[model samples]
Target: MEVKGKVVVVIGAGKSGMAAAQFLASHGSRVYLNDIKTRENLEERSLHNLEKMGITLLLGAHGDIAGLQPDLVIVSPGVPLTIPPVAEARERNIPVWSEMELASRFTKAPMVVVTGTNGKTTTTALIGQIMEDAGFKTFVGGNIGVPFISEAEQLQPQDVAILEASSFQLETTESFKPFISLILNITPDHIDWHGSLEGYIKAKAKIFARQDEKDWLILNGDDRETRALAGLAKAKVLFFSRKHILEEGICVENGYLVVKLEGKTVPVIKPEEIFIKGSHNLENALAAVGAGWLMGVSAESLERSLRTFPGVPHRLEPVLNIDGVRYINDSKGTNPDASIKALEAYPDPIILIAGGKSKGSDFTSFAEMIKDRVKALVLVGQAAGEIEEAVKKTGYYNYYRVETFKDAVYKARDLANQGDIVLLSPACASFDMFRSYEHRGEVFKELVHELAKND
Candidate 1:
């Protein structure tokens, strides 16, 4: 786990790659950063951040395995294992790990890691907020932004680190056990990288691989996929359920978020008190409550945190209520199940914007939610036609489709009545249009503002 004075080769040069290189170099490792981006593009703000960290840049080029004998090679979540240098690294028997793994090994700090196909952002933010309110110095990032290892040396043991761990980051991790770890739920996602549903599940289960009996593992009792993997964790398993009521697991009992353990019913908080909405949000809240309880956060603090917490952006985030028309930016809905949850969050007639880079979700089920709530479909990005075709095959036709995000919003403005909800819940990835989901969501917000100003 030690990287001191080691020659480390960092791959990808994206957000994670840059952070890993800097984190390794800061700890006295000589880090070489590699990316396929052109020298001109490498001058962007993202890579520029790494230059000051003293990493040797290998931009406009691949990581040359022959030139540098690296003690460690770090790969980003988005990087493929099939990439030439990565394959070469494997052939050389060079140790490869993720930014999260490297960070965990260096930090003496205790962490509460949240990983799930959905709700990771909300749960991670919620845990950090609760711990921070309880007077813990909190470092809240990982897959969210700025890996904890990048700042762990500056943080004390009394400080808490809450990470939004992703399946990709967990894939290459070694010895990255959290003090408290929770897998919220697993649904079919990232089929593009994983190549199958089973592969994706395998990647997510890696989060619990490094835990010990003394450590605690929380799981989604509601998700069968997550529940099936609970037996593998060396840590004690605690669950939060929206499906089955348990004698000990977190459940909605008597309108309270109840955590019953050892015949004692403790009220962690209330579901309605949470700022977020829908059954999914309820599950997300309960999961956070369970994590909070495991971390020794008192019920009172959790209740207060629930009322005070502002939910994470782009997951059913209400942007504006213009003339009684509520527009929600759920650009975080990068998969079909996530979009379905966003749709269920509101009953208002939805002018649904639902398309992007399709992530192999069977969009046929979208008809059930769309038929009941959607007034019109405003589609964008590469998967627009595919989403529209699914609407047709599901017998919910007559939905409109627009090509660009701006056009989608404009048509939604026309189709939406004063009481309607215009929601951008693309059930696919955002790479076809925007840099990231956040970028796509920001554009949606800006266009909404522009429309309002003209009105």
Candidate 2:
């Protein structure tokens, strides 16, 4: 488990890969970094970090992964193990791992690990805030843009860290266990990376893979995928659900959010008290409350945080209300299920903006929900024609296909009338038109602002 001063070869010179290489080198390890691109094609800034650590670089695809004789192979989440060199390394019994796993082995701090197909960011951020409010020194990072090794050695057991774990990281980790593990829900996500729905679910289950019988493992009891796999957990089982009440967990009943713990009914807050206005977010709060319960945080603090937390952007973010038609940016709805949830949260007739890079998700089920709820559908990005076809297949004809987020927004605005909602809930990836879902959401917001100014 001791990775320090060992021979470490980090595959893929991406953000997490560079962070891992630099951190390993700083700990006296001779690091070897590799990337798919040639040296000249590499961005100068990333290479500079490795240079500062004095690590050796191997550019282009040709790598002696098996020849390095490295003690550990740090595989970036973006790198597939099926890559010939990496597979060859594994064949030689060279241990492979994620940066998160390698970084965690060096830390003694207690952690709150959060993983899901979605809501990982919001739930992790909420857990971090709750831990901080409980007077614990908190480190918030993992899959959410921060590497674990960067801060692991500096942490104490008194410190509480929240990690947003991804399936890619979970699949490679051997010792990436945590004191409190939260599996929000398992929906079909990252199928491209995981290769199948079953593979993805098994990856998410690894969040509890390393925990002991005493550790706290939180889950979503309502999700069939998560609930069906609960028996695989070694740790104590705790859950968040909307279906039924538990002696110890969070739930919704009679339109109220209740915390049932140790024969006590504690009301952290009601469903309506939550600032986040979607069904998925309500489930996210339940997961956060479950994390808080284990941290010994008072229900009062959980209630305050739930009501005060404004919510993360690109997940049903409301931009402006123009002429009684509210515009919502839900670019984070990168799957059919996620977009279906967003559509379900609305009561008013919706002028929906949907489409992006399809992840092999069937938008058919969502069309049923959209058909009844949507006033008009403005499609764009890679999946526009497919989504339009999907909507039509549902026997619903109110749809349009346009290019660009701005054009989509304008078309939605024109189609939207008083008391209607304009929603940018693309049920696909953003690679076709934007750098990311955040970029898509930002463009949606900017265009909404422009329209507001004109009105």
Candidate 3:
């Protein structure tokens, strides 16, 4: 772990790269940050900040990597292994690690890593809060908008790191084993980025790849893809289910969340006690309870955290209720299955705002869900036509296509009635209209607030 004079190269100048470069540079490692983006594309302030930290920059190209002769290379989650620089590093036999893998070497804290197609953020945040309520020092990060490397140096042996790892992050990781690894569910998502659905599953499976008998793998019992992974996991696998009563993991029984380990059963909390809506959110809470128990959190503390946690934004978040109409910003529903779950959360008539950059997802299931739940559909972004085609097949004609995001919001408001929910749960990525799902959700909240003020 000593990096006193070692030459290290950090790939991708995004958040993960910035934190990794800063960590290595501060630790006396000669750090080189290589990014595909030019200086003009990056923010001036961020560039100056990295320079102040004494990290050398290799921007706009990957040609300089061969000359660097790095002793080690750390890649950001977004940087794929297929990239030339990373492949070149592999060819040179230079030790390559993901930012999380490198961060794990610096901290002795036990990690609870959560990864799945959806519900990762909510589950990770819930587990972190559960640990905090149980009086444990916890650092929450990874794919939840904060890089683990940023807090790696400050961790103590008694602490725990709750990470919301993504498939992109897991693909680059080698030695990133967690004490408790949870896979909520797996469905077709990010196929465009991972090249294929099988490829995406392989990357997600990496989260528990290095785990052994001592560690725990909490998997979703109801999800077919997740259930199939039990055979591959080397660690002791536990299941969490929303449908059936689990014999050895976590599940809901007779309206209460319960843990059944060995021959004993302990109830955690009722589904109604959780502040978050939706059966899917309940499943997230179930997974968190499994992870919390593995981390030695008391049942009382787990129930307390479940009841108090208000849930994360961009995932079925209620912005404001105006004139009996609820505005929900589920902008994090970036895939067909996620949007389908969002639709199932409400029984009220819905004016659903959907469509964005398509990830090559099948819209048949999403359209079927909408046909029953959605009263009116407002479509925007690049995938409008594809979604429209899918909806038309269901004979749901109460749909409108908008050229702009703002127009879609206004149109949904105009089309909605009292007691109806205006849900912005796009079944596509936000890259076509915004920087990210968070950005898209923020914009939706602002627009809803503005509409409320006018009323």
Question: What CA RMSD would you report for each candidate?
Answer: 1.6, 2.0, 1.5
lDDT of model 2 at position 246: 67
How many clashing pairs in candidate 1?
0
User: Per-residue alpha-carbon lDDT of model 3 for 47-112, expressed as tens digits?
Assistant: 898899889889998776858899999988767787887888899888888888899888888899
Tens-digit lDDT track of model 2 for 1-455: 66666888899877788889888888888899988888888788778767877899989884677777888898987688888877887888888999998878788898899998778888888888888877889899887757887888899887877899888889898877898898888877778877999999988888888899879898898888888877988898888996787667789865678878778777778888888777888899999998888888998888888878888788888899899999998898999888888898888899999999998877788888888888888888888888888889889998888877778888888898899999989999998988788888898899999999998
Ranking by TM-score: 3, 1, 2
For each candidate, what is the lDDT?
A: 0.84, 0.85, 0.91
Residue 323 deviation, candidate 2, in Å? 3.2
Regions more than 4 Å wrong, model 1: 44-54
- Residue 201 Cα positional deviation in candidate 2, in Å, after optimal superposition: 1.0
Order of the predicted models by lDDT, top scorer first: 3, 2, 1
Cα error, residue 376 of model 2, in Å, equals 1.0
* Residue range with the least summed lDDT across 10 consecutive positions in model 2: 60-69
Looking at model 1, the pairs that clash are none
Better of 2 and 3 by TM-score: 3
- TM agreement with the true structure for every prediction: 0.96, 0.94, 0.97
Instruction: Give stretches of model 2 more than 4 Å off.
Output: 38-43, 253-256, 453-455
Across 150-185, the per-residue lDDT of candidate 1 in tens digits comes to 787777777778999888888888788888888998
